[model samples]
Target chain A: MLRKADTSATWAIAFSTVFFFIGGLLTTVAPPMIDKTWSKPFENNDPSKGPTGKLVNYTPQQLKGRAIYVREGCWYCHTQQTRTLLSDTIRSGWKGVRSPVSTPDEFVYDYPHMFGTKRTGPDLSRVGGKYDTQWHRTHFRNPRDLVQGSIMPPFPWIVEDKEEFESLVAYIQTLGRAKNWRPDNDYEK
Target chain B: MPEQTSGRVALGAGGTVPAIEHCDTTAKWFMISSVSYFFIVGIIALTIAAKFCWPSLLGSVQYLTYGRLRPLHVNGMLFGWLLPADMALTFFIVPRLCAVKLYSEKLGVATAVLWNIIVLGAVVTLPLGMNQGLEYAELPMGLDILVVIAWLMFSYNIFATIFARKYEAMYVSLWYIMGTLVWTAFVYLTGNFAVLFATGTNQANLNWMYVHNAVGLIFTPVGLAIAYYYIPKSSNTPIYSHRLSMIGFWALAFVYVWTGAHHMIHGPISQWLQTISIAFSVMLLIPVWAAVYNFFATMKGQWHQLRESVPLKFLMSGVVFYLLTCFQGPMHSLRSVNAIVSKTDWIPGHAHMALLGAFSFFAIAGIYFTLPRLFQRKLFSEVLANWSYWFLMIGGLGFFVTLWLGGFWQGWQWNNPAIPFIDTVKALQPIWLVRFFSGVLMFAGIVSFVYNVMATILGQARDEAQTV
Candidate 1:
């Protein structure tokens, strides 16, 4: 293998491109394919068990609030994905229900995918409907007012802006209910 | 060959200096701009760090909210400071190694100007509540296009210069440089554009891919390339093993792209992708250590030079940090460890060591080495440089330790069924304050850096005027 003292730049570039491209395809490109393939069967056979087949589209107000969430960078401190681990599931699960493992279809409509990297605060996947609009209002206006020692900065400006405040509330309320747990809400009713 | 000679000759014939004949001015502009960004972004980071301990520091302003400020700090550092500094060194390195001029010096300068504008755009837009909400790829679609185009122009300029090179045997640094340019284009485009088409799990996959590759492919490779070039230069020796370098380069390029999905481990991403990410992350240790060993081994008899040469000191310590980062990276990707630290402050701690400790250290060292050549004078004060160096080293190390401990504490407390979330937040307050002060020290280091650089250039001008 070391016989040749000189390696071609062409060969080096070609080797890297091929492998990296394959890796990219395998991870980023291929997963969607896996989703498309597995999604239908999971939808038909195990709708109650696995993923909710279709994502519930956000209303106009919810979309506006979603935009506000993006604007505010809320995802930096709060993660939306409740992973399968006990630590994540236990905290993020709905009352008396184990947290459903987040599935591909649940995010079918999410463009930027807000499955955040950190959890400086708690996971927000099941935060929707857990608290009333008033709690969210008070909390956003000043986090430490409700939760002692919270490092989250006050969003009093948002509280004053009714549209943005309600919009963010609407968006927050759609988190876990976007797909899998909507059925649970329906079942409970 | 004739074209190369004719280009040089043509420049000599004209009274106006050939803009493409050398890279000094363009590289210097990038270096200066990069250093300025370093100081500016360091302050923004300090503000965010302060907000951690004192949430009301600027809590009244809508724009000064922690959410907005955090992204500004992150994007400002990534796009403004680190990337441009890498570009500056790349421009400087390419010409000297090839024994030829830059393909277009004006193009390089234009790219730097546009890049600064783009960074400024991020600074304004993020705070103005105009963001796309994806981490790392947070720039909105409009600005995302600008980034792609900038890189396109940059890649074109770089490749054209590589094509016009007078040297025959391609060095290892050239390979890394080319890899960075090409891979960044691929990563940036796919990360931003492909997400528009993808939804749900696919989007998550793509986003993490972009996020991880931004550091692993672009910053990591570029950083390694600088270390490869400078370590031997500063040590006054040839590389210990070319074979080892070759092994490192190939292994790194093949391994790193696959490792991005580790960010999505235990999440909704397919299990196989997680497995691929974990496997490759562990495999990454080989290339990482290989490069580290090569750097240290090259310093066999020259270990004493670390005391005298500031650049070598920075570069060697940067290598050690890189080694630690890579070690921590593979270990964290393990499912067990990932469970504990995946969403903790620990991730940011790991990131700081890589960005501040490894690459930014290399960038600082490169600036110290190149400024004299660009300005035709020695640094104005060795004391300031040493001071800045110690500040960065201590600040970086302290930040890493505090954040790692805080992350662990938060993760452990959160894992307990009985502990409320507020308890975890309260527990980390002291650590967060330490992080803020450490960040302030890092900010001070950048201030020293800017002052020293300006003085070095100004001192050269003064000396020339006196001689005249």
Candidate 2:
């Protein structure tokens, strides 16, 4: 007995209401499920106490550079975390003669894993120990200069401002502190 | 036979059954070419996916890795198959809607041929791995230029036709079509940056912005326009509400662009950037929900048409999935939530649900609805059309659920310092198997639809053609 237009309007309202309810319900419930399934069992984990904690020794200049990195959206393309699994750790330089994996107890204090997706460029989780400050500066200025095939857009302007540059370096060094927690390594000396 | 001839003669005496036969032939050729293109690209994508399931199938070529092939499959679907067919529908619909013949048949044919050439360029460059490495901008710079040129030509032809309009008030559907064309051209040019040509860190921000707009401005508008036109026409009624349509259209145009940064949630981006992205994404629910409401409301009482009309079946089902994708998209944008699901198959599940489930379904419906009128013939088999609908619908649902669940599981395990990454992959092996099965079902559905479309265009003329 309903007119066609009325029927359509009613259907639209019903469908939208149903989906809205479903979406809201899922958001409310998803986090707990994630925690239940994924929470790690490491009790003694504290990233600052590990060998990579050498980053804690960063100078004021390096710390300043790190802050700038965060401000410029560089994290959108780069990740600062590595899994302990052999394949990923090896491929991303988290393990080898150059870099070794941190123990399970090392990572518990981390708030949000800064591991990024979309490797628009190489992984930056261990970049603090891998490249010198000058190299980092040049690469940030124009990535293509160092790596011919790199698709990373140059952050040349990051260098133009000395204060901002220092903050960004400081931020980048903090990324993998758990893996390099040893105190005497002098990460930013 | 004599009685039938006498009846036909009597009816024909009134008017000479205007010779639209030439239009019919050309339209058939266009449909056949486009559908074949769809089948070819679909099969290639399936094969690439299969290669992922069994890596040995790809031999030792770096070009065949999951990273490269993923972009190729996506591009093939978005550009090769979907875009061509949508263009064909536009060519057919714009003329009829305006109550005039297409302004230039030659231009239309030229656009169709250029589309194939651009897709061919993708085929050549992508396998060579000569990419810009930006997601959705993987087509090499040279090929990207070719595509831009083709789009410019197509936009020119469409706008010229619009300028030549005889109707005083532009219909809602025309607004959507014109907006999509103009907005896409501007976004494509700026985002790709032929001027900057891959220089600044702006590339990251620019890439996501362009790709998201491609979804919002280009595909979403075109799909909605087709739905608006066909749903009302097929149901033999005016749309449920014109004002709601205008509101949905404008709100979407304004709000959707600001949402690209949601993809960067929890990353090293500025806190404000991520925050604003999340805010706008959540706000997007307003316009999206309004559009969903309009679509369902328009179809409310017309359940009978859904049962009998193949086009209606595809269109209504598409609307259902569009609501699902938009809601999921905003949820994934939230930082707390994205902390777990970012960079996982969950993202692809949402993407496919939007592109395959929503846009492609509406597109197929538009094509099916226009076929009889354009070609002057009945579908080769309504039963096959019904089968295709159910196959795609069920298969797509299966694909979405399995991938989303698997991605969630992977995200959780990867973030847990106690859980080994290998263990997470081990846990997900079962889910990936489910994905393969669901993918098989989807592939079968696409093949069946392609076959049905081909038969309709190529089969011998029926004794009594069905009117649209």
Candidate 3:
């Protein structure tokens, strides 16, 4: 009976391994390699040349802010990716005009992808140019003061520390902006 | 792992075996650690839930920020509590089932110590803003390696015991345990390593895979393993059908791994990948129902046992939660439902229903059943045990239902861009308060349960000492 059970154990091991491999390969491995079915990564490590919009690379200051963003886990509440659906496109966009869906190419430089799982706050995919630098500084200090009933916790440190404030605002201002997306909109058209 | 020196000895040298030869020291330590952590994690969770309603309550200290505490809360609950709880139960239950002793109690204890170190590192560093930024896989690279080592040690001990078993035909519970040993390692390595090699959407896919599978492979199977054992044993009944157990085991192994990508539905991914995930996710029902059916069927005429037997009460409640959680899983994975509720408060509600509701109950039941026999004492207080149960049941139910309603409300509000986002936050404030209070009730239950167990064991030890 033990010998028979050993064989069953081996069978269990083999069955699960095979399935894990197949599932992982098809989902994680196959998609990037098969560009026709999915998406091709951006070449020259340039977000500015992404397919949907021209996104400039982050300044060094903005990169510093990006690190702070990651450290603070801003991604827990705010999602970076805007989906293809109308709700996401319009919701992320300020005016009647549609925001382009977040594609893999736009995230080429994103080493550890921050396509966050939750959206307690509104999606920040196209938050670039939505508010000026001063607005962000005050909002971070006391979120509820600017936006009544906002449940976001105050980050007074962001206001007090110059580097943390400037860099974070700089990085956020670069989210999902095309070369002339809001200015000369005819480029996208 | 060295085989036992003799039948009476649970391990070779280096183990201070318990006063009762049958009860392993490592199991006791792990159980005590798990219970203590469960209580600690509850406080952590309550703080976070409090911050959700009263955002400024904890102040703007960097270490105590929402993001840092959120990950710590998660890691504490998973590693500090559930994983060790399951490990402790495995140590106690497996040897008896196999008609053998543990491979090495020293190794088991060492692994438990290392596991604590790993969690401690996470608790400290996460607050200091040191993290890998992945949900569930947030431990930095160094600690992650330590985890792999700790897992290896525990697995070696467990597998060695199974190999040395005198019992020829392995029971259903043993099968589940063996499956978890293999699946957790595979899922962990893949999830952790994927960040190094994979990038962009592939990383996202792998991340969610890790997130989903961490529970599916680790907690779910172990919870079921203990359930398969304790439910029948505590209820004083034979298993309903051996064939059904086989079907359930094989089906769960087949369906669970592929469904991780369901978390990425309507997000940027290949359409086929999303399709495959949803397809496999729905198939999860087969295994869930099959196992649930067998458990219920086993208790056919044992209704009174559920009332009399404390372990049976928790195990039955666990089985019911398992059924509800699995049903919720597949329903939420659907495209339409995913669009509405994927990233809302609903997902956390679903998660707690699985962990706090189903798995924690199983762990509680296992500890209650095993500890008494080991220490040679009746429970400290049956009334307290029942009290803990009622508190948790009401609290867990209130917590889940409120978040679900809040999730749907927020989801609808977010979809309509015209509605100001602040309105949604304001609405959830009341729900968050309710969640915080529900957590308080759970914390109360945990305190009660832990107190009862500790008193029982300490009293039993004192009695034994007096007689000796």
Candidate 4:
């Protein structure tokens, strides 16, 4: 069991790891480059005109709903970020909706960034104006009733729990509406 | 912490026990605790997989929803099951490798108990929405601090033991253990606390760095340490080449940390950063193959041991899965492949092949090989042990295959906007069901393993130390 104490071998591993680590960090060490049009809406009057208007901060109620969204793990299934691809923009919302790809400016205040990794359901990046409040209420209560093939779990608590339902819906409407809003499905067309 | 007849000598190296004389309390408890988490977190895994099939299975309970349960499952599996298992085996192997009793058996036991408390904290906090919203570092701040403290204690014990070693030259396994102790501390701290200071998408940088290195720096190295020690010891041979071992350890340490940004390939992270990460990820193949070659080469004359030796069987196949898992990691890092499958079920499939298939195999093999030595008793049932292996093999393979294929379909479907997103989710339902059943099979295998281990431990001790 007694091998040579090979302190050099030990030193090699420790130093090499430290060296490469510093090199690795050096690559990403800079603060992320801020986008040119981060929060600026395309049109001053219309946030949805293009990716030019300011990103709207959440109202107190929307903030409350964002908490519920996180608490319920909506981010696990419904992604918030739109990838830099045609399919992501088209699939996250229909082409007529003119959904912009998610940008860092829209998430300036996103503390624990809800830009989820997977699309277990759909990208919620442009879900803000896609459906009305009543539609969301119905969808949250029993998703299967609205969408035939949906696997989203029913949040019946939101239906019965007054404050929970309001906050969640408020947050849902703000998804892509604040800055990257698409007011109508036919806008881009 | 329980019953200890202090002065018993081990059945060393070949036909016998651990390579040293020390109290088994710390290592044994850590082993038992980790094994028990297999059932606890295995159930959690099954439940999570099941939710994909039946999303409303626990629809009403706020705590039991898929969202809360999912984080718990990951935390439980990583911290509760995998990390603890690695520590358990490390506690056992390092002392033997160092040719010294553990520096402080009492401290080891205390750390073991404290580690459990940290996991328990995860159980309570995560379900109640107390998570930090970080992936691997999800445990609340208090638990994170507790974990760091526990690691410091354990690392201190291991470092002291190595320092006290009477030998002039250290082994390859010792090199890995030492490297991981230093690397994990750096990775964990940077990922968890430092990210708080990063604003906007910048946090994603630290996040990926932390999570990827969590596997690369922490689990992979230590898992190799166990495999390196157990393969040679179980096969009753020296490593095929000390030089290869040297190349593998140094190369892996250098490459692994740089590859963290691979997770964000094609995403919003800087393009150059992604390219650099992917390059380093591919470079990882060199170290991975080096280790794999060494393991297989050591098994050259010992190939026949696969038939008669259950532990060797596990150790060897673990090597195979390690090869497959490592291969997939770099392939997925490629931008072309990453564009399609990075966000799909393929990611988890890649992960499971390593955690459940590769490392769990090594950890279990280590337990199977070392348990008898600790108590100086025979395995209660070889039939049961083999059953565990086959079950895990089938189930683990099934889990990876179904998810990999399913994830590809998902990526393709999403790529076609005409298909509609809901349809894509619907298309994956059948695959999710298959994954759920695979989860069932894996749970069964774990139960079989736990029972076999329990019976072996409780069975009568051998009368004579020289019997083997």
* Error at B374, model 1, angstroms: 1.0
Instruction: For model 4 chain B, give the 10-residue run with minimal summed lDDT.
Output: B1-10
Tens-digit lDDT string for candidate 3 (A1-189) = 223443344555666566667766776677668754233443343447533344456678878888888888888999987886778888776567777677666665565677898888888878877888888988999998898877788899878999899889888887776423454443220
Sort by DockQ, top down from the best: 1, 3, 4, 2
Interface RMSD of 2: 14.6
User: Which digits, one per residue and each the tens of the lDDT, describe model 2 over residues B236-310?
Assistant: 777888778877866676677776657666543345556777998999898788888998898788877888888
User: What tens digits encode model 4's per-residue C-alpha lDDT throughout B293-406?
Assistant: 999889887899899788898899999999999999999999888878978988789889998889989999999998888877788777778889988989999999999999
Off by over 4 Å in 2: A1-189, B1-30, B194-201, B460-468
Return the lDDT, model 1, position B263. 90
- Model 2 has a DockQ score of 0.04
Ranking by TM-score: 1, 3, 4, 2
State which candidate, 2 or 4, has the greater DockQ.
4
Worst ten in a row by lDDT for model 3 chain B:
B11-20
CAPRI tier of model 1: medium
Best by DockQ: 1
Candidate 3's residue-wise lDDT over B311-397, tens digit each?
Answer: 888899999999999999999889988888988999889999999999999999999888878677777777778888888988999
Per-residue error for B89 in candidate 1, Å, reads 0.9
User: Per-residue lDDT for A39-146 in model 2, tens only?
Assistant: 342232465543423212346665455434433334434555443344335534432333454322333333222334533234566555545668778977765576
- Candidate 1 residue-wise lDDT, B282-307, digit = tens: 99999998999998899998899888
> Can you tell me the CAPRI class of model 3?
medium
Q: Which regions of candidate 4 are displaced past 4 Å?
A: A1-5, A8-13, A31-50, A95-98, A181-189, B1-20, B460-468
